[model samples]
Target: MTAKPPPDPAAPPRSPWPGSAATAPARPPEVTARRLVARSRIFRVEAMDLIFSNGAQRTFERILGGRDSVMVVPVLGAETLLLIREYAAGTDDYQLGFPKGIVDPGEDILTAAGRELREEVGYAARRLCDLQRVTLAPGYIQHGTRLVLAQDLYPSPAPGDEPEPLEVVPWPLTDLDGLLARPDFTEARSIAALFLARRYLQQAHQAPAADGKGRSAPGNASSPSPDETR
Candidate 1:
């Protein structure tokens, strides 16, 4: 008839600590502090390094330093994606990834994106989406890599004065699963870029019907919806 004392208040109000709410102890301070003792570069490869910071050693790869740059994912046709393989002397392995390079001191990321697209794939994009900005490696590197999604492309003249022997390869979309599953698809920046690009492309291709025939305004158009299928 007394409602069983309201079932002892249903587990009691949480005191944010393991003590009686009426006399609970104060909570500990949140973790919001860190110190950078020092940082030194022990080894420097092109755009990368083996760095030691605050007694912690890590690989610092500068996809883009304080400067601006771009990474272009070129989707050719509906079934193939264009990629580049450049012989990386440091690792002595062919690094296959979206075309990416430094921003040449004063250029913006978007401009550099277009330039890298042309240089690596001999193509230009009529429309490119800014997918996201991400750090190459936050624990060590002081730089970030910008991921861009490119489409509506056309062949441009070869970057007449090529600097490196870049092999432009057309990989079938169906093979993307295999490429990612391979043991060597392991570079941080490239991995991040490919995943972001793949996610964006998949969503774009499978996008639901729009209410109208005309394409949505540029900013209003979908910008790489997260991988719902996954």
Candidate 2:
């Protein structure tokens, strides 16, 4: 008898790639039942009873997610990157990062990206390109983040729920080393989006087909909108 091989990480996924395939393990554990263990204003903890294919059983805890979120990488100019300095309760300090917000119900990811750009960065993008979707702390968090590249921006502002106004910081993409050296630019999601966006822009710039039409880059395709499930 021959044993079946595990799924190949190098192989393309059946659906769009959401996270790093390198992190995926073969034969995912099936969740038998989920029971609410605790609830707070912002978080709901669920106790998950899971059974692996090999007959192993374990209990895991995860936070119940409400809605998807979008992180906007707005291009201020040929070399400029717009970031925001906002207060992070988890860190108990301010962090510098991109314009990001939750995707409200009934709105698609692209629209939500544009909305967040206006609300957080005081600008609305004429062309919004999709970069990728990222999951932060996927082992416990049920939510995912959609990264977007915003270009051809025009001044537009909207009211936001932030207790204090966010300080918009414009950094040059060429100075990534300097930005990374800063103590405040430490958000994992933001860091990933920045690098991905930079790579996409570089590819798009190299591609003759891009032609500054605001389309997505060649290989970095956008995932399905928030209205669709993976």
Per-model CA lDDT versus the true structure = 0.64, 0.83
Off by over 4 Å in 1: 1-64, 158-163, 210-230
Q: What residue pairs are clashing in model 1?
A: none
Cα RMSD of all models vs. native, in order, equals 11.7, 7.3
Query: Against the true structure, what is each candidate's TM-score?
Result: 0.63, 0.82
What would the per-residue lDDT of candidate 1 be over residues 1-230, giving only the tens digit for each residue? 11122233457666556553554323322223333444456422222223222234343333224554577777776667788887776788887777887776777767778888887788988777777777765655566667777777899845634566688878887786887876655677777777777766666555555556533433122533343223
Best by lDDT: 2
Segments of candidate 2 deviating more than 4 angstroms: 1-26, 210-230
